[model samples]
Target: MDPAVLREDMVDGLESDAKGVLHDETVAVAMRDVPRHEFLEDDRTAYADRELEVLGTRVLAPSTVARLLQPLDLEDGHDVLLVGAGVGYTAAVVAEIVGETNVHAVDISRPLVIEARQNLARAGYGGVLVDCRDGANGFPEYAPFDRILLEAAAVDPPRALLEQLTDSGRIVFPCGTQRQRLEAVSADSEREAFAAVSFDPLLVEGEQSGAVERNRMTREDREHATRRAESRRGWEQEWIEWEESVGPQ
Candidate 1:
């Protein structure tokens, strides 16, 4: 099937089932134009609504990406920062909406960042900057972003990212370790929380060593283990306790 047709099918599904999460026409066009297959090893599943693991990191589902982006109200010429550039698919989509030169993406995993860079270039979005760094600290060299999108889950907007936002900028991220909620926060500190989502917690430098080990496990087994872990009472309690101890203030 033509990739463009498949992309339109995907966007149509998102619009139909997203429950208003993907109402932006500009975002829809961006989603359609960006070649999602170029960013994944398996093009067969490029149009699937489910998330896929790329280079050991989970690339968020298209609907999830749409939900996170919708509240940001992206516009042309806006300077956007994308944290957790898993495979650059999301960044490419954003770049299409807000000009390639205006998008910057960062990931802590060097391999992922390199691959993302290649993927972005292959998709003709080479102008979007893809950097390998601890994304917790927003790229300060390009201070004051008009919009920030963190693909990974965080307990709160990192102080550094919040500081880097323009006075009227907005940021969207998934909060909570276990029971995550998509949140959009403005420079003025106003926040809006949306539907629950399950996302891999954002890891910082020196914290992703175990990710390699986990990826080494058989894919089916790994997925089963992940499902079990998310459902385990002890795991939930641990996150609750940790949140109580050190969650965002």
Candidate 2:
């Protein structure tokens, strides 16, 4: 069998599986549309196969990609963020769901970001922000995002990221350690708080979310705020007493 045609056939079969499990037809099209082989370069035969390792350096499961797309329930036009763009293959898929104008991707690897930038273009997903930098802090310039996806495993939830999301946006990632879980964090617009948070036992170690350090400062912040409030109250009382005698305005 020719590898090219075989690849297409395999993808066709994968598409069968996708259609059954995936509820969204648009997601199904994007799954079938983007040539999985282009994103995965080393699998001479993965053009149709479900899994591929890019340049023999990174491994990505086509099923995993498909699964992520399902729960996302992404609308056609949305402002989305991806933390670990890798070679940008997943980002490209996300770009398809969200469209090019509203997709933004970030990563810590320089070469990977460059590769992703090019791959996104090849995938016909232009205007995405694929940048090489620490994904730990999250992208602030594009704040208040609607959807944020963390691609890597984390030891904690990335705080900088949580703060950047629009109130009511969704953040999905794997969290926890020793026993990791896939979790989703959702904000509640009505209450101005997080309404839904689901944590599932992780399949792998959690990705470092940079929340550890911020969490460590929690006690200090509380103590500092308490002291400041007490001081302000004391000053306000003294000023009021003085004004009563001096005739206040």
Candidate 3:
């Protein structure tokens, strides 16, 4: 409820490190423009002060969402399809990042989608399209997006999702069943090839139960990483360094 703690916890926690800032300008504007607490449940309204609510099946942590967006390199002129709309909190933040006309969100829960649409409307965001549908599969009717982001963790990237990307499009999400991870996927339609970078999934205490333990990349995924690394013979040194920064396998 207190704006002071909200800024300190979510905003400050996210911005404390330079590496944490994804769309800095967008975050700044959203921080000032949107009323995030309004969308949370009655009891957890103030949790926005330092907490995130488990809205339906999706759990939205302010800091986690902010961290997720960091590597996206999103900007204007990009049409983004967001999976897991959540109570529209992530959508609102994204709506602030990418213009409304360029954003659409889909969720599996009907009630959540209704609430998402209304919440965005109440926030005066006209660009985001909230649909009640499966998030694992992107909105195909809109086909071919410049960018795709999944808010939920999956063991692997869904097949249908890749089919919807415009050439050279990029996707960022956490993947892996037991050993969940955050990965960046970039596709080259001409070659039908996609390269991804994955890190240990963010596993926190008191979160969802039944989640599996983190594992090294699958044998295939590992080989892909190795082959991709080898393909860049000249850049091996740098690529290796980058891989190290992502943390050990």
Candidate 4:
């Protein structure tokens, strides 16, 4: 039960014809190198192809992670941004492929961000950047990432994330709300769907864990009302009396 042997078996299973979730040699090697146990509390199940919940966020299973990353076509020295850095496992795997300094991750939950940072550092990827920011907003401070991977599901790729992609950059995300598909989109707006996937919806600022407002729709409604109030016109603000206007004139 050596961790290295476990890692090797994990990648091998993913590459096997029955699963075929992992085919890219680069990604396969990276998965083998990154110690998944460093990111999980139970070392016994570290290499298992199953999801686990960490800090109220669901950590993607190994096969799911492979499916998510295989579409990115990651390259050495590529600047990558990972949205929804749950347990930092995916970020660590990516760092192994693209160097530690090139990986940047953002999460809406502050506690998860802190945990991911600590886990990543312990995993020897201390150079990777883990920040607490709403995944939809993305990490704009480091704009123009060469590759962006959104671990959560959204009906459409967030506008901010798309705007932050380099001209040749590609973003891989689970696209949709009710039903999801693993898809990749280029900065030029071309898209390609890979497979059906189920993922938690992307969290907004007020919907994240430990936020005062846990209801995303309610916050959205409040913001919509604010926009409506700001856009109120002459007649839209209050009811106008046609009779009073004529009489006054």
User: What's the TM-score of every candidate structure?
Assistant: 0.81, 0.66, 0.66, 0.91
1-249: candidate 4 lDDT, tens digit per residue: 899988899899999999988889999989989999999977768889998888787888999998999999999999999998888989998999899999999988899999999999999999999998778888889988999999888888999999999999999999898888999999999999998999888778788877887767777898999999999977785776757766954
What local lDDT score does residue 221 receive in model 4, on the 0 to 100 scale?
96
Per-residue lDDT of model 1, residues 1-249, tens digit only: 888888999899888854556888988999989899898766659888898886677888888888878877999999999998888898998998889999999988888888999999999999999888889898999989999998888888999999999999999999889789989999999999987888887776666644444433445576898898877885565546765667698
Most TM-score-accurate candidate: 4
lDDT of each: 0.86, 0.63, 0.65, 0.90
68-175 in candidate 3: lDDT tens per residue? 666566777788888877778777777777788788898766667778888888778856899866565678889788888877666656778888887878787776
Query: Across residues 148-240, which tens digit of lDDT does each residue of candidate 2 receive?
Result: 877655655577878888876877776554454455677552211211222222211122233234433555777898897787854566556
- Clash counts for all predictions: 0, 12, 6, 0
Order by TM-score, highest first: 4, 1, 3, 2
Off by over 4 Å in 1: 17-21, 209-249
Local error of candidate 3 at 176, Å?
1.2
Better of 1 and 3 by lDDT: 1
Name the 10 consecutive residues with the lowest summed lDDT in model 3.
202-211
> Where does candidate 4 stray beyond 4 Å?
215-218, 223-234, 238-249
Measured with C-alpha atoms, the lDDT of residue 84 in candidate 2 is 73
Model 2, stretches more than 4 Å misplaced?
1-12, 15-23, 42-44, 48-52, 55-57, 189-249
